[model samples]
Target: MPEVQRIVFAGTPDFAARPLQQLLDAGVRPVAVYTQPDRPAGRGRQASASPVKQTAVAAGLPVFQPPHFRDQTSLDELQALQPDLMIVVAYGLLLPTAVLTTPRLGCINVHASLLPRWRGAAPIQRALEAGDTESGVTLMQMDAGLDTGPMIAERRLPLPATMTGGELHDALAELGAQLLLETLPDIEQKLAAARPQPDTGVTYAHKLSKQEGQLDWQQSAQALANRVRAFNPWPVCWFEWQGKPVRVWSAQADSAEATRPGTVRRSDERLYIATGDGWLELLQVQPAGKKAMPVADWLRGSGQALQSGEVLT
Candidate 1:
């Protein structure tokens, strides 16, 4: 077999594409790129390539889209590449032991969380929902277990109280790319000195579902506001208004008092709704079949007749 100087990249989304692009731009080109197969999306349901696939194609790298690696052929094909190392970032598939051991230098994963915490699917959303004050990326030496690997390096970012999930995702993606570039030069030494994650503070971020968007007015105002921040850009928090769903894009909790939960409360040109505790100010909203607009603009137009003391739920 040829000397194992080749790197193999496996990732699927835009978050993963950033690191791959960094690798290419730094002249550390992968011999083969592996991404998930095209899947249906949008109103037409037409097949669409993942962001990582697009990046690999534009860079003129060979691409692979095996459905799974359970079959021997997939393992054989991967082994044939004679890769020195493999880098995985949100590849969406679990790697079997066979494939993990194929690379001469093994595999490394650029996980979005600080490791041990938010160890599964929706780390960004989970962190936001839990109101974590900090977030970061972990460069891990891949193991058979789920994100339970030795950490080679980590980079932390302060989580602002008002930061939305989409904003944090973008910030971490860029930070992960920069850290990956910096770590590549001393990867061997870093892997050797990697430390084990503590058993405490372990948490799992389960994948979110569309049903999670349904807003419950009975919850605490702060809790509801966190959900709105967590679920933005996907499965957005919403409430039924006049038989149509109205997406809540941005909101905040205040100390205003109201008679009951879901009761609309106003203070000096601002709109707030009572929850189990305090009130939630609706900053931005998007009604079905309408673009997102400020609460004031939406109120002036569609919300002209709606008055305070009215209930949202």
Candidate 2:
């Protein structure tokens, strides 16, 4: 194994921050940290530092926030660091070939999904949406292609039937952190032994959009239920109800007979929506301008007079 000195880290978001924090906690601090530039966030739309930048700042590490490494000046600045190795996790920027080879040992990325699968943005959500029974983290040697890197190390985690995207994200973040820590001790050896990902079974996890969160009643009830789990804590799944959008936070698939695709029924204090195959039981939902609550609570309160056989578009 080669002696790893002067490490550089590049990442953004909470998922990336966790591994950076773990590195610091383990006394393997990076010489410099690179993150995306501050951007407008939240309802205020005020400039806010990314989670990795915030963590770097708190640790008194040198922080660089370049919009993208498209300029010669940015590339020169990174080259000046003379990093022995660079660790990237959810950095949200495509690194050019120059940056990839700048480091002595090259750059490595901590991706959320197993390589040749979910090889783009929104992997966690995509995995849940597809109803995969298992998910894992992959540490790969970075290449020019998008997440098309050779695998250095990987760790798998079983997915329960009720796992949500948010839940899986948190789990995989910590798992990735642990995997990175373990790989660092023998990084050179692992890199030397890294294997190319198989071309078969490849699937891209396309970036998510708010429009995709709209529930399609024509889909199977189980599929709709999976979507509800996949999209939670994000552009949550929703349906139009009386000219307003009702967000479905949590739901379950049932074998109840289907009526019209979008028809809704109330029974035994539970709310059910008919789908192509069966029914989807709405466990939690949020009205257009209200907080999310259980189906029973919503039924007793604002949804008291919700008529059975009412259709949700």
Total clashing residue pairs per candidate? 0, 0
lDDT of candidate 2 at residue 48, scale 0 to 100: 98
Alpha-carbon shift of residue 155 in model 2 (angstroms): 0.3
TM-score computed on alpha carbons, candidate 2 = 0.98
Write the residue-wise lDDT of candidate 1 on 241-278 in tens digits.
78888899999988666468888766445688889888
Q: Give the TM-score of candidate 1.
A: 0.96
Q: Which ten residues in a row have the lowest lDDT in candidate 2?
A: 304-313
Candidate 1, position 122, lDDT: 96
Query: How large is the C-alpha RMSD of every model relative to the true structure?
Result: 1.9, 0.9
Question: Which ranges of candidate 2 are over 4 A from the true structure?
Answer: none
- Distance (Å) between predicted and true CA of 76, model 1? 1.1
Off by over 4 Å in 1: 1-4, 267-269
